[model samples]
Target: MARSTILIADNSCMIRKGLRSILQNLENSEVIQLIDNKEDVCGIVHKRKPDILIINPDMLPGDCLDVKRELFNENKLSLILLSNRKNLKNDLKADGYINYMDGQNTILDMMQEILNKNNKSSFPNKNSETISSREKNILKHIALGLTNKEIADQLFISIHTVVTHRKNITQKLGIKSVSGLTVYAILHNLISMDEVK
Candidate 1:
């Protein structure tokens, strides 16, 4: 598995240090770049090509929207905007947002969430095959100890439909047993450990 590289582009010393501290603790994390220069972030991202780029929209040089558009156009690196405000504007249109008002835990959680979604090896299929919403709900239902009949009833589908979905889920996930599926659901945050009982 290739190590994941993360770049932090915030001019603020405090925010940079905080992000670095939080990111270094993640597994498979390789390089965490803390940008001291407040230049064109998109150019830096194009040059470095880090797995993820966390930047403050307010700190971007020139038009923030233009930079965001340029970064979006590049499409190689994932963009995560960091904001000190509680309510973020809809204009920046970043892939992810971390609000400073939500505190340190929120930053860490958001970063981890983005990394999880973007990390290829995080899933059974190397994150190649996207799990449909219906499949995810079915997986959750199976993990919660619901039988095919019960699931069908809850989902308003036929028992045969539930069985077919179960077969497809097993084939896609490579998890045959209900226990294995339960563990997968828990690890992927589809269901919580507390909800297992």
Candidate 2:
């Protein structure tokens, strides 16, 4: 089997380097791209077309959610958006927010999980008024502080879709701000205090 290509996007060179090393060590993984410039992530994804894209939520510029969708447009690349552990249960990040008790280990684990899924392109159905699986996946990233672009890359959805999820989530829950959604997620058991705090 061909080694899986990995893309790293972050504003910090040191962080990107560290992630690059980790991915390099994986048996089927290779760091095919590294992006420290926010302006370049979208363009890079379009050009390189890696199998998996790992991004830091805070690193991307402009409505982070928008970036998520942009990357998902032409490919089925899996995403690994680093996020705080508290985010899994709550909030409405544009997308690409994944909670990790241990950011590094969690990322590796998530990658393994995706591989287990064999890069299946099936996402949560889009019908119904309640939060769909795709929305839930993105919300998990938001609570973790992932930006829109990060979420898009992670979920393989469009930035527009990530934004749509955020809007729909807020409308259904009657919440807007991140803090408010975080709190609602916690209070309603959508997420736990441990995850929120």
- The alpha-carbon deviation from the true structure for residue 119 of candidate 2, after best TM-score superposition, in angstroms, is 5.1
lDDT of 2: 0.68
Model 1 bad stretches (over 4 Å)? 64-67, 121-197
Pairs of residues at least 3 apart in sequence or in different chains that clash in candidate 1: none
Query: What's the CA RMSD of model 2 in angstroms?
Result: 20.9
Residue-by-residue lDDT tens digits, candidate 2, 60-128: 555344555655766877766754546632433432444434566665676667654543344343324
TM-scores for candidates 1 onward, in order: 0.55, 0.50
Worst 10 residues of 2 by lDDT: 119-128
**Model 1 CA lDDT for position 118:** 73
Return the lDDT, model 2, position 31: 87
